[model samples]
Target: MTELTPREIVRELDRYIIGQDDAKRAVAVALRNRYRRAQLPEDIREEVTPKNILMIGPTGVGKTEIARRLAKLVDAPFIKVEATKFTEVGYVGRDVESIVRDLVEAAIRLVKEQHGRQVRGRARAQAEDRLVELLSGATKKRKSANPIDILLGNRPKEPELSPEDRDKLVVQQDDVRTRLRAGQMEHEIVEIEVEEVRPMSEIPGMDVNMNDMLSGIIPKKTKLRKVEVREARKILEAEEEDNLIDMDQVYTEAIDRAEQHGIVFLDEIDKVAGRGGGSGPDVSREGVQRDILPIVEGSTVNTKYGPVKTDHMLFIAAGAFHVAKVTDLIPELQGRFPVRVDLKPLSVEDYKRILTQPENALIRQYELLLGVDGVSLDFTDAALSAIAECAWQDNETGENIGARRLHTLLEQILMDIAFNAGGGDAPEVTVTVDKEYVEKMLGADLHRKDVRKYIL
Candidate 1:
C-alpha cells in the first residue's frame, strides 16, 4: 500500500478496465489518502476521515469491478451490500448496522487465513503424526477385564508390552508415517472422530447469532466417521491450526483492521434515492438514508467481535440512477459521500478491448474452458470487430447494459459448440471464429441490419 501511489494505482486499474478513467482516478486518490492518513500523528490521524465516493453510472460499467479489484489489490476487508437490501429502522428486522458486523466478519476471516498460512508447517506435521497413528493402529484404547472372557477361560487384561514389542510397534509406525508423507495412503479409509458444529438458528432479516452467545456453555458433539486419508488430513490440520492461533489476538486485530481499512461498497443506492410520492415505499427509503448517515458520518457499531468505528473506513456508493437522481437522497446521506464520479458508457472499441485485453479476458476465459476438452479456439480480428459491433448495436437498440451485452452475445454464439465439444470422447479439434461464422451463427438473432456500419 505504501509503495502504490495514486498514479500507479490508476495504471494498474487501466489493465482491467479500458475506460472510465475518472472513476478509477477517484478511487485511486481515495485509497492513497487512507495510506497518507495512517502516517499522521495520533491527534491528526483521528481528525482525518475518508472522503467517501459516490459513483453515478449505469449497470455493467465497471462500477462494482473497480471497487472489488481495488480491495483485492490491497487485501483489505471489503463487502458489497445493496442499499435496498436494508430498510428503515423499524419496518424490518434488518438495519444498516449489519453492514459493520459483516465487515468485521470478513476481517476476521482474512486475518485468520493469514495466521493459518504462518502456522501451516507446524499444523501439517502435527496432522501427519496423528494420521500415521490412525493408519498403523498404534493409538489404542485401554483393555478392560470381562466376565464373559473369564467364563470362557480367557481373561482380558491390560498388556504391558516388552521392549522388543514396543520397538517393533515404533518401526511399524515409522513405516506408516513414511507412506503417509509420500501420499501412498491417500485413498486408504480411516475412521476418525470429527466434531459437528451446529449452525445457529437464524431469524429473517436478523443478524444476531446465538452460537457466539453460547461459546463455552454447550459441549460440542463428536462422531466417528469413515473417510479417506486425504480428507482426514484436512480436518486434523484445521483443528490443529485453530489450537495454534490465539482467538483474543485475532479478535483485537480484526476489529482494528475493520475499523481502519474496511471498505463497504453500498451498491444500488439509487433504489433508496428513487423519486417517490413520499407516502409509500419512498418514506421508508428516506428513513433508510437517514439511518445510513450516522454510520457514514462516523459512528461506532457494536459487533460480536467488538465495537468497530467507521470513522476512517472508506465508502464507495454506486447507483445507475436511471430514474432517481442523486438529489433524491436525503441531504445528510448525500453530504457524507462528498466525492462523486460519473462513469461514461462503454463504446464499441471499449467492448473489443474488454474481450481481449484484461489479465483475465473473456475470450481467454472461454478458450481455457473449451481447452479442457481438447477444443482449441481461434478468434479472428474481424470476428472480434463483428462481435463488438453486435454488442454495441444491441445496447443502443435495446436496454443499454453496457459491457454485459458482450457476455450474452458470446454465450449465444458458443452455446452449440460448448455443449457438443466437452464429452471427453471427441477428438481434439480447432474451431476458428471468423466474421462469417459469427454472422451465420447470429444471423437475425442480432438486430437485423443491411449494413453493419460499426464493424472495423
Candidate 2:
C-alpha cells in the first residue's frame, strides 16, 4: 500500500477491470492522495479533508468494483450501503451510524488478527502452562485414588497426600505432559469447565431506563460451559490473550485505522436525490439524504461503541442518475461531495473485452464452473463473438444491464452443459457461436417486441 503509486494502482485495477480509465484514474489519484497526506506534518494534516467522489454510471459498469478494489488495495475498512434500504423502516432501519459501527468492527477484527499473529509465541507459552496445570491436576487426582490400600485388601485410604507424595506427583505430571504432546493420550477425554461468550444485544437507552425501573426486579445471569482439555486450552488461551490486550488502545488504534484508510461506498444515491418532498416516500428519501449529508460533510456520529468522526473518511458514492441529475441532490449534500466522475456506458467492444480480457472473465468463470463436474468446455473465437453479440443485442432490446447481460446470455447458452455436467464423463465440448448461432438463439422471438420483453 505504501509503495504503490497512482500509476501502479491503475495498473492493478486494469487487471480485473476492462476499461473506464477515467474512473480508475480518479480512484487511483484519490488513493495516492491519502498516502501523500500521510507524509505531511501533523499540524496541517488535521486541516486536510478527503475529496469525496460521486460516481455517476449505470448498473454493472464497474463503479462498485473500482471502490471495492480500492479498499482491498489499501486493506481499508470498506462498507457499501444502498440509500433505498434505509428509508424502509423509518428510524428502526439500520441506523446510518451502523455503517461506522461495522467499520469499527472490521477494524477491530483486522487488528485483532494481526495482534494474534504478533503474539503467537506468547499465546503458545500461556497455552502450554495451562496444559501443564491440567496435567498436574489430573496426575495428583489419579495418584490420590490409593492403590496401596486397595492392594492390601482394605479399601480404606486417607484423602490427603503428603508433601513427599506431592513432589512425586509433580514428576508424574511432567511425564503426562510429555505423553500428551506425543499424542499418547489423544483418545482420553478429560472433562473441563469452559466459559462461552453469549451474544447479547444491547438496546440503546435501555440500560439507563432499566436500571431505574427494573434493577431491583431482575438480575442478569452470566454464561458458562464445559468441554475437554484440548478444546479448553485453545478457548481459554484466546480469552486470556484478549484480556491481555488493552481495549481502549485497540479502540483508539481501530478508529485511527478506519479514519485513515476507510472507504465508504454509498450506492443508489440518486434514488434519494429528487427535490420533491411530502408525507410520502419522497419525504423519507429527502430525510435520508439530509441525514447522510452531515456525515459526509464531516460530523461526529455516535455509535453503540463510541463516536466516530466522518471528516477524513473517504466517501465514494455511486448512482445511475438516469432519472435524476447530480444537481438534483440538495445543495449542501452536493457541496460535500466535490469530486464528480461520470462513467461511460460500455460499448460492444467493451463487453467483448470484459468477457475475454479480465482475470475473472465471464468466459473463464463459466468454463471453470462447468469443468467442476468433469466436463471440458472450450469456446471457439466465433462462439465468444456470438455470446458478446447476443449480450449487446439484449441490452439494446431490453434494459441495458451492462456487463451483467453476459451472465444471462452465457447461462442460457450453457444451460444443458451446467445441468448434465456431472452426470457422466462428458466429452470435450467446444462451442462455436458465430453470427448464425446468435441469430438461432435469439431467433425471430427477438423481433417480437412483446416476446423480447418477457424473455429478457
Candidate 3:
C-alpha cells in the first residue's frame, strides 16, 4: 500500500474497467489515506477515522468492480452485501450487522491462508511422521513379556533367550520399518481405528446444525477398518494436521486482523436510504438505514465468533440512485460516508473499448465460449463498431443500463449463429458486422420511433 500511489491504483483499475475515472480516483485516494494514517503517531492513529465512500451509478458501470479490485490490490478482507437484503432489528430478515460478521469471516480466511503458507514446512514433517507411524504400526505401545512366563501349572522356571535370537528379532523389526518407508509393502493391509463422525452440510443457506448442540449427547464410536498401508497414510496425515493447529490462537489473530483491515462493500445502498418517512416497507427501510448507521460510523458488532470493532475499517457503499438521491439517507448515515463519487454512463467509444481493449473483452469471452464446441468465433473490427453503435442507439432510445446494454445487443446480433451452433461442421466462420450489417439487423425498427419507444 505504501508503495502504490493513487495514480497507480487507478492504472490497475483501468485494466478491468473501461471508464469511471472519478470513482476510481476517489477510491484510490481513500485507500492511500488508510496507508497514510498508519504512519501517524499511535495516539493520533486512534483518533483518525476512515472516510467511507458512496458510489452512485447504474449497474454494470464498474461500481462494484472498483471496490472489489481495490480490496484485491491491498490484499484486505472484503465482502459485498446488497442493501435490500437487510432489515431493521426485530425483523425476521438479516440484520445489517451481519455484514461486519461476514467481513470478519473473510479476514479469518485471509489470515489463515497466510498462516498456512508459514506453517507448510513444519506441517509437512509432522504429516510425514504420522504417515510413517500408520505404515509401521509404531503408534501401538509395546508391552514387556512377564518373567514368570514359563509358568506351567503355577510352576516358575527361568527362561533364557540367546543373544543371537534377540539380535535377529531387532533386525527383523528394523527391516520392516525400512520396507514400509521404501514403499515395498504399500499394498499390505493393516487394521486402523477411525472415528465415526456424522457428515453435515457447511452451506449457510442449508438446514444444518452449526453449533452441534447435540454432539455432547451423541457418543463418538470407533470403527476399525483394514486399509492398504499407502492409503491409510493420507488419512492419518490429515488427522495429525488437525491435532497440530491451535484453534484458539487462530481465532484470536483472525479477529484482530478483521478489526484492522476488513472491508465491506455495501451495494444498492440507495434502496435503503428511504424517501423521508412512509408506511410499511418504506418506513422499515429508513429504520434499517438508522440501524446500519452506527456500524458504518464505527461501532462494535457482536458475532457468534466474537465482538469485532468496525472503527477504522473501510466501508465502500454503492447504489444506482436513479429514483432516490443520496441525500435522502438519514443525516447520520450520510455523514458516515464523507467521500462520494458518481460514475458516469458509458459512451459509444467506451463501449468500443470494452469490446476490444480489456483482457476479458466481449469478443474474447465469446471466442472462448464457442471454442469449447470446436468452433472459432472471430469478430471483425467493423463488427465491434457496429455493435457499439447499436448499443449506444438503444440506450438513447430506452433505459440506460450502462455496459449491460452490450450483452443484449451482442446476443441479439449472434442469435442465429448461436442457435444453429452444432448443426453442422463448417470450414470456417468469418463475420464482419459493419455499419451495413448493423443497419441490416436493426434498420427498419431503429428508424421507426414507435419501435424505438416500445422495443427499446
State the C-alpha lDDT per candidate: 0.87, 0.75, 0.76
Overall local distance difference test of candidate 3: 0.76
Candidate 1 lDDT tens digits, 1-456: 445999999989888888999999999999999899888899888999999999999899899999998998898999999998888877854799999988999999999998989999999999988888788876665365354664466745556879998899899999998888788999999988889868778655554667766655554556778999999999999999998998889889889888988999999999888484454556777888888998999999877666789998899999999888998888788889999999998888999999999988999999999999999999999999999999888877667799888889899889888999876478999999999989988998566643455557
Q: Model 2 segments beyond 4 Å from truth? A: 87-92, 120-194, 204-246, 275-282, 423-456
Model 3 regions lying over 4 Å from their true place: 121-245, 276-282, 372-374, 409-456
lDDT of 2 at 210: 32
How many clashing residue pairs appear in each of the predictions shown? Answer: 0, 1, 0
Model 1 residue 56 distance off true place after TM-score fit, in angstroms = 0.7
Best of the candidates, lDDT? 1
Task: Give the winner by TM-score.
Answer: 1
In candidate 1, stretches whose alpha carbon ends up further than 4 angstroms from where it belongs are 141-162, 203-208, 274-281, 448-456
TM-score per candidate? 0.91, 0.76, 0.74
Could you give candidate 2's per-residue lDDT for residues 255-314 as a string of tens digits?
888878888999999988775433444667778888787778888866544678888899
